[model samples]
Target: MEIREIFAHNLRALRKTKGLSQEELAHEAGLDRTYISSLERQIYGASIDVVDRIAKGLAVEAADLLRCPEAEATK
Candidate 1:
């Protein structure tokens, strides 16, 4: 998968695992709910700062959100 796709997939999984809706995550991250949805959909690229904010909101390391499953298989 593309890096953006990986980010989107991981983001969705993490959000679900945390039992948080997009709106809740957005609120926690101090971002707009629509922006969160757009990120989850891979409709836009996220800056490093935004990624950090998302990771903080999810209580996880930023790198965790960037992990790509396909890249792991190539390892």
Candidate 2:
């Protein structure tokens, strides 16, 4: 998979772990629901600022949004 796909996967996992729906997460992150959906689907790329906002909203470090923990194991 591409790096973007891996990021989307990690984001999805983290969101689920936090028990947040896409809409809820979008609202909390000050993003649009469609945009959030696109991000989760790897259809849209996120800027660093956007990632920071999402990480902050989810109470995670910014690296948590950009880094793939499982991918590290696979590598």
Identify the leading candidate in terms of TM-score. Answer: 1
lDDT over C-alpha atoms for residue 59 of model 1: 97
Alpha-carbon lDDT of model 1: 0.93
**In candidate 1, what are the lDDT values of residues 1-75, reduced to their tens digit?**
888899999899999999999999999999999999999899999998999999999999999999987777799
Give candidate 2 regions above 4 Å deviation. Answer: 72-75
Residue range 1-75, candidate 2, lDDT tens digits? 676787688788899999999899999999898888898888977888988888877899988777767777899
What's the C-alpha lDDT at position 30 in model 1? 99
What lDDT score goes with residue 74 in model 1?
A: 92
What is the lDDT for 8 in model 2? Answer: 86
Please give the CA lDDT of all the candidate structures: 0.93, 0.84
The positional error of residue 70 in candidate 2, measured at the CA in angstroms, is 3.1
Candidate 1 RMSD computed on C-alpha atoms after optimal superposition onto the true structure: 1.6
